[model samples]
Target chain A: MRTYGNSASVVVLLAWLLLPFATARAESIVLASTTSLDNSGLLGRILPAFTAKTGIEVRVVAQGTGQALATAARGDADLVLVHDPEAEAAFMAAGHGKTRVEIAWNDFLFVGPQSDRTAIGGMTDAVAALRLVSEAGAIFVSRGDNSGTDALEKRLWRAAGIVPAGQPWYRDIGGGMGAALNMAAALDGVTLTDRGTWLSFANRRGLVELVHGDARLINRYRVIELDSVRHAGAKLGPAHVLAAWLAGAEGQAAIGAFVLGGEVLFHPGVREIPPGE
Target chain B: MEEFVPIVLRSLAVSLAATGFAIAIGLPLAAALALGRWPGRPIVVVMVNALLGLPPVVVGLVLYLLLSRQGALGVLGWLFTPGAMVLAQTVLATPIVAALAHRAIEGRWRRYGPTMQAAGASRWRALPHLVRMAARGVATAVLAGFGRTVSEVGAVLVVGGNIAGFTRTMTTTITLETSKGNLDLALGIGLVLIGISVAVSATVLVLAGERR
Candidate 1:
């Protein structure tokens, strides 16, 4: 018993000794971002450049775009990098964001099993492809997580004039892009995923891109700083620096230069301002 | 693997600190429940035992709100930090430690109570003696608490935000790497986590054997 007591005390002492190392840090900013960007390894490739140049370490909390916006709305993050334009507009209009700037752009792709049961291969129109899948009752794995890709998928379904909620073929898996893709592979179903995450994803399990090159498939990423007036503790200085750096020449170059397996994932450009900006 | 060292060390530090805090708060509560004559002792015991099954994600959500900038405790700016992660883990671990320690200490208290009372020792006064006598059982309880915290990913993921090089732990890193489709790295981290659990359990068993 005495030996046990001594061991417990030693463990507790070591814990106390290492506690400070876990908490101490220099200048840093919390950036709530979408899982697609993080899964694509874009941030992993480009964030170090921003940190090295500005000496401000970026701690990214990757979630769905909806969750990322919600996190920033609650003042839990200094800034946000997400691709959901409608949700971003709602967040800014609700007075949660100080500034919003488009940083980079990617497009969503419809991917599924290589067998092409629905024969959506080489389809350029997403709405038409989705309608064909719905009519054929083919397995469709929906992200169902309120992510940017999920939002776009829902919009395409609406445009197709099909309500797929209660359909037996629509498998709504409330998960991330990669999870949705894995599910699609397992069930031999189809799912919508961004170009970035799809390119970097390794567990394809015989899944292949089936549909792309639609104008409606464009996914634009934006960086937004939290409103300092509402969130008094918001790290506006570093947030502003990071946001500006992302839209600046150096950051744009970094985004464009990030390539995976000989393919550029994202295009760096602010083609147009957000609605009501 | 070099990058993983810091993640593993941070996970150990965070979980250990939370377990230490839980033990600090739990042992006394356990002794009180086991030995003291209180009006609401049964209710307190039931509550603690029930809390043993508290969902970690709910705890994380509650702590996230309390620590958010818009919430009441926002002044501390602990959200998305290691401090918040520790608090969430402590909340998760305290009930396990207290309830299990209560069972261990209660048995020793019943066996040693009459002698201590005959020697004119109060219930509070006998706490240390009872705890020492029940050290092996209490150590087991502490190990259980440590194991729970070390293996938990839900609460830490929600509260710590899984920041790289900061709040990321072994379990959270596994979750992140899996989502990123880095199956090799994720499995490697998972193996390390299991190895740590095995090592700690073996150490405790060896110590218990020494007592015999």
Candidate 2:
């Protein structure tokens, strides 16, 4: 008020310009990111390096994409990294995440026991494979926790025209990917899991990837900076930095390199690069 | 609604099976701990006391790690199976039973012990009376454990896999349907769980009260 001669609008402009730089100097920036970031060990690997370079400690709170966005909306997190596009779009429309950037993209796979028992490989579609599992009454484990993976699973069920709510063969673990995968492994059932967590826990079970690269499998991830106006603690500057870095060369390379058992976890970016010449 | 019936039944089967196994193992073990006084008894007692309120998620995590196909017990093929779930529930319930029994037997040594000793009866004679006096409290413990085994969502969700018509239990069913925005099925399962809990408490109280 004193600097702007009691002008509210100019005071707002000054406040907007000054916050992130001052925040970077004084406070740690907290981010509520997704399970993929945490589970793939990307955040664990890169956050420390980012901190070492920037002198700003990035405290990444990891949760499922739905929960991460919801956490940001509640102002618990200054930013969010999420996978579910529809849910992410809803959050942006609601004025939560003001800046969004495609950070990485992966694919979901219908994984099962390696005996080729269901024979849904090369089917070129998710619904047909789901139907085969249903028709055969082969077991299928679901995350069922309303997570991003769970949401994707539900979308496929709609496409497959199978209401799996009460299906005897369908199992919903109502948990995170790790636990759900454990159950799927035990039962030798079909399940749709993120390639990251699946690969991390792959060797633990009898399960193998049955389907991938289908349109339904296109799992894209993005980072969004929380609108600081709505959230008092939003670290807009570093959040955008992180997001931009993720969409840049080094970050894309990191995404492609994140692996388990020598299998690439994510397919990096299919988004267009900038114009040349 | 018809589709969920089978799921509910499967959950009930798992819940009942876990409860039965808990009682089967917890009761005898609890009885032994309550009556036995030996070296490390206090330590065992303390550990059991601590485990009485163990969070379902923690138990689930330990069990998951131990039983995951890549885990140490993975070769046993128990992860996500009913057996692993039973093992987790049993671990959770055993401490509850032991703690309750320990508390029930806390102060009855003077009057009951002397009376039985004066009657020319052995340690066995005093045993039944101790059992009789502590019956109601022990029953409450069992009932509490049963309620927990049925109402728990985390452990079952983690360990049991909530497989419909397979490992799905009522608690996890309620969680799944509620999260999926299926209110009717969730409510139905919730109401059934409440009924089961009430029935269990009432039956234990009545039976224990009769014995006293």
Candidate 3:
């Protein structure tokens, strides 16, 4: 009505286009997580829900447990979801992570080919099974990648008081769980793997569960916020939110109920005794 | 990633070995095709061409089946070593090199094949000349194959197991870094890879040009 529909409207239109740019930008948090949780679809199922409810955008970068922790140390990621508690504690003590807490629990099992010459069948004891595998030189496959699974496997061997070097049948496969399992299956050998990924593997042609359900077979997962102190100055906003959300009840429940092949894959727990605790 | 530099270097060494082995296998075969005519030459050409598209994972799968502890080549026990990675890259690189070399030589062989014959040179006597002429193209093929071998993540990850301080290669390092969200390290490794590729390609081009 005031003849404002002239060329001045172009400036108004440009202002309209630019007005949204002045508002506060949503802070997107990057979470580096293990392949197990990501592959298990827990992140997929939970992230969308979290974003919808909280309006915080989340970007996930998934890999093996070791890589995730290493990434957090580099300050490239705000948070990490990983399973190797000992390593996570080391990271925390190193000041790479500000706060770390156990968010889930699972078990590691020895998988093997069905012709159980090691007689691992119906055996609930993992140490004994390992002893048999080692003594028999039964082509034991190792995830020699220094991954959490690999680290645990090495610990078990040491705990059992066995050194697995230069043994013809004791093979070191510096690979992922799937590759290690495949290596073992092809050889009909024995190897350690996380139950979640192993149970999820559809190509379990000749593989069978050998040793699980052992007290020592306990597997735990943790979420840690990257520490900027060690990093010499980095923003902790996303890291704080990510760690808080993971420790929150919703995050813990989301973890425990995550499934693989229609079976519950993880048992989340907020309370875990840290090393020397 | 800076963390995986040693790994990538080890993998680069393996790729070099694979390229060396593949060029050894491919050159003679390419030369033979350039000089000789066999009953199944057409069939051989088609086979080599088909092999150009061989998937690395498929090769990895086959090698895994063959070299796994219970498999046929298990006695070699090379399942997790840089050797296995070299073997897989060798297999993948051979066909590419052979095909490219053959294509390069065949076109020239038609023109130069009879010149030597006219000069009372037996086809066998013409071998050296043909090889000299094809050397530049063959060098390029070998360099390209090396590029492919060094940059591959799947086959090496499958065959070598991406073992830290062992069979870890540049490709696997990038993957490990990315998933770990160590973008700085990942970018560092990526830059190294690009640098290596550029330097190698330039060296090959210079060498090829000099020969021409």
Candidate 4:
């Protein structure tokens, strides 16, 4: 009995001793980001070095792009790393964000079971591919979380002139990119996902990329600092610093070098890269 | 419907495993706190009770830090797995079990302690009999733990990553679907989660009635 008491106290003491070191210090800034980027292993690759070099600790909160932007709007976070271009524009137009700077780019891909049940492979036109998949009544899983990928999928469906909501073949999983990918792998359904998450996903379960390289499939990530002058108490200084860092040479190089499973998942400001380069 | 099978089964398995571990460890801790005489016992009891309200996200965050790639226990690599879900659930459940089981056992201990002491029986000797006498209470404690873990999302979502056919339990699925605006799917899963809790309560009642 005495032994158990002593051991319990020791365990509790150890926990208390370690608690302070586990959390970021007072100098840290919260950076809200999309789950796709966080789960893609990009932030983990870059943030440690970012913190090490600049002594500006970035505490990342990975939510969907919509949620991340919402966090910034609420003044809960200093900066937002998000990919929903439409939402980013809306945020800036609404006078919530100071500016949006392109940091990196990745394309979305239509991936599915290796069997290619929809036969939409080799298709470069995203809308046409989606139209064919819808016409065929093939299974298409959706993340349904109103994420950047979800928003893109909705736009594609609209472009294809289809409302896939009630279709038996259309399933909404309502999860993040990885969860949707796992569902696609499990159910042998087709789903659209960001290239970064697709590259990091491990449980392929025979899933393969079927369609990509469409102009509409391009995914652009941006860093936005809140307009702190309007929204008082916003951490404007660190947000600007981090945003500049991400758009600068070192951040671009870090993004260019990030690889998973031997594949470079994102191109740093891909629009800036010349055709020959 | 077929897709939901794995989700429901996984939820049950993880919550059940969590409850099992909670009971295994909690009962002894509850017994120790209830039966043993110590100076700091009141403080220990208060701490355990306070832990019953431990935020699920904090539990998830702690476990996540302890299990991430850069975490101290990252070598196990259990993050984003069903194993991680179970571990997080266990953390959430253990305190509930300990606090509730202590309440249940303490009453019985008070009644049995003096009698045993008069009979020249050691404090430890009364534990088994007291536990048996307090079986219904312990069962309630187990149910409480199960109830908390079965429908929890925050901790499991953080640790489990909510992957399909791996870590996507009913609660996590509901949370995801709700955020995605898939109310139909979310409602369906929500009903199933409620159904599970009802079924558990029914079974517990039936067994208790039979014992009576």
Candidate 5:
């Protein structure tokens, strides 16, 4: 009986300790977002200010843009912050999102080893540089995870009129931006990466930006509020609050203010115009 | 880092809570399986034993499907929370504790069954005595369950979403930092986790020595 009492008391104590975790906070919302945004430390830098101002806790689940959209589609998240415009349009057309707004923009860079084997260094034309890399059969690491970056890479390959797939020079590692960058560093290969993640990444052994400022290389990040009518469990109020806050002046300033190593990561206040305008 | 302390504390609290739930459900099932004579007893024992090898990722995926907003149990809204992580860890640790406890209690039942039966003790009546006599092994089984829950990252990662300062455990943090190419921070967290494992093992050894 003594042992039973002691164990029962211990169980009660554990339950007491876990009670807070079992309950949901009314002002809290889940934001499904991309690894680029998270790995860049941008969200870490700005989210605390949002939370402090609104008293709303934002829990971010950082995945690829495709997975982030899919997570919101499944009603697992109240909002999504991603950079894949085509996928975001498709998700909106599918009625998974109520509202979408572009919050920031960053350009992608063609990064490769400093050896410049294909002589793509200081190249302004992304398509031509990719063609050179492809013709030279230089090792190119691909994200291949249906992320926004992967989508852009596919488009670039299409423009170059070359199928790097089934070629030994192309390494399609279905992973995040950081993973692709790490692989690129390890193999001394070339890869496309967002400025944010590339700036924050620390494992670069010999990689350097080879191509940038192409019209097709702009990466735009947007925040979408999940449709509460479709998903009853969606924290619509808090989600709307967060979405509005992100597009508003304070959030835009915060995004602009986020810097790493004396370089601004994202340009804010780029509103998305309605299509067919 | 200043954040390291909270992460360690959260990991301990979550795993400890999960181990408590595993013990609450597993010990009775273990007792019943080890001491009772029932139809399909062999199959039940075999199934429990087989479940000992259940993959954490598979368990995580299934639990994710079950707890997602589209899932049947979605109304409970447990996904991406510490609650969900605890539930996943409980599912993972339960079978381990049960199978290990079953093995230990079965051995005790084999040695004491006839004598207890001659004294008119039914299996239910003899359960407490057997458990008490096999206390050391049972404690080890509990420790094994704790170890499993503390070290596992897959299930928690799937269900908890690895939200910083919320559902992030030591293993999940290590995974996240490594993926972010912060190998030094990841190694630091890994060393902390290893230190914890070593401490738990030392405690187990001390208990064993005391029993001897």
Candidate 6:
């Protein structure tokens, strides 16, 4: 009787008292970014070096670009690393961000089943390819989460003068890029994705890159610090330090050096100027 | 396979810790609800049972607000940490624990109360003795709490931030892996989770059988 009752109570008490002690204590700063950037394993490659150099740990909260920007706007994150220049510009205009700097660049590649239902292979113009897919009645998966990729896809549809909404062939999945890609693979559907994620994603499920390398399909990543004045409680100093380090020479080199499956995922944004700036 | 070990272990550790805290706090609350005649005792019982139906994400969201930088407890700086995950799970599990524990102890309390009162025992004096008598059923309540906490993904992901090698847990990893099209890894982790849960349930069943 003593063994059963006392030991059970003792174990529970010890676990209750001792478990919090297991959590590690580290000075950390939060970085809200897109799932494409985080899921591509690029951050895992380069962040450790940054931490080694600065001893500042980065905690990444990966969501869609829109959600990431919203997190930064709420002062929930110290900084935001995301694509979608339009959203970034809007964030800056709203005075939520102190500064924005280009960190890296990748192109959007159209991926679909090798069956090529839309016959979009060898197409260099993304808008024309999208129009062809729409006209062909081929299934196209959209990352409907208001992500950078989703925004760009909408822009492409608008340029092609086609409303993909309400179409049976068009499915807007309100999820992350990786999820959209997975859905596309499962349905054997077409999708537009950042090259970094497309390259790093291992479960292709017979999907192939159908269209790529158009200037209109460029995906550029930028890091922005939340306005310190607006977010009085934010870790502004470390955020700025991390922003500078990311846009600096070392960071650019690290981005350029990151390779997956023998393919260079991103081109370091060393010399290229951001468009419409 | 190698990468999944830590995530599974983290999930177990967090859920177990949450269950431990839930039982510690919930058992006493349940005892009070069973034995005491308070003004709002019925409302409290109703509230506890209703809380068992509370969505984990809502709890996660509320806890997130309380733990965010601008939150009331933000000074502790536990947000986006493993500590935050445990806190969220405990908050989610406490009601389940209390509700089930109340049900378990209420029967024993009714049977024991009249006899103990006849023997000149106060409610407080009889509570400890009643809890000891209902220990087996209380153990089941604790197991149910553990199951609820471990299987939940919403709260832990929201509070833990799912940071790799830091706050990543089995359920969160399953969500991420499945979404990322890594079905094999997700399925593997899912199998392991089911195995562990089945093992816990089986152990409890065996213990109960032996007691019977």
Pairs that collide in candidate 6 are: none
- DockQ rank order: 5, 1, 6, 4, 3, 2
lDDT of 2: 0.69
Error of 4 at B196 (Å): 26
Better of 3 and 6 by DockQ: 6
Per-prediction RMSD in angstroms?
2.6, 19.8, 16.9, 12.0, 2.8, 3.2
Tens-digit per-residue lDDT, B1-212, candidate 3: 23454555565577777887888998788877777788888888899889988999999988977876456886675665567888999999998888888877776678888887898888778877776787777777888788879788788876666544445677876765454334466678888888988887886777666667
lDDT of 5 by residue, A125-237 (tens): 99999999998999999999999999999999999999999899999999888889889999999999999999988888899999998999999998887776887778888
Name the top TM-score candidate.
1
State the displacement of the C-alpha of residue B22, model 4, in Å, after optimal TM-score superposition.
Answer: 13
- Ranked by DockQ, the better of candidates 1 and 6 is 1
Candidate 2 residue lDDT tens string, A1-277: 3324524543453344334344545545556667666655666666666666667666555567887786577555566788887787788788776667777777888888887577886666888888888888888888887678889889888998889888888887777776676677777877888877766552345777788878878887777777777764456777777777777887778777777677777767835322120
Candidates in order, interface RMSD in Å: 2.5, 22.6, 19.3, 12.6, 2.3, 3.4
- TM-score for all predictions? 0.94, 0.53, 0.55, 0.63, 0.92, 0.91
Candidate whose DockQ is highest: 5
Selected candidate, larger DockQ, 2 vs 4 = 4
Q: Better model by DockQ, 3 or 4?
A: 4
lDDT of 1 by residue, B90-170 (tens): 999999999999999999988989999999998888888787788788888899999999999999999899887778889
lDDT string, candidate 3, A1-277, tens digits = 2224433643453344233234524755557677766644567666766777666666566557887686566454557788886787788777787667777778989888899898887788887888888877799988887678888888888988999977898888777776776677678888898877777655566989888888888888787766666753334775676667777888878776676667888886786445443
Looking at model 4, residue A261 earns an lDDT score of 74
Candidate 6 Cα misplacement greater than 4 A, ranges: A1-26, A271-276, B1-3, B202-212
Per residue, candidate 5 scores C-alpha lDDT tens digits across B1-212 of 22888788778778888998999999988988898778998898888888888899999999999999889889898899888988999998998889999988999999998999999998889988888778788888888999999999989999999888788889988888777778899999999998988886676555644554
Per residue, candidate 6 scores C-alpha lDDT tens digits across A1-277 of: 7448845854664464345446433457889988887888888888889988887888899888998898778678888998888998898888888777778888998999999978899999999999899999999999888899999999999999999999999998887778888988989999999888888776889899899988999888888877778888888888887888888889888988998878899888743234345
Worst 10 residues of 3 chain B by lDDT: B1-10
Chain A of candidate 5 compared with the true chain A, TM-score:
0.92
Candidate with better TM-score, 2 vs 3 = 3
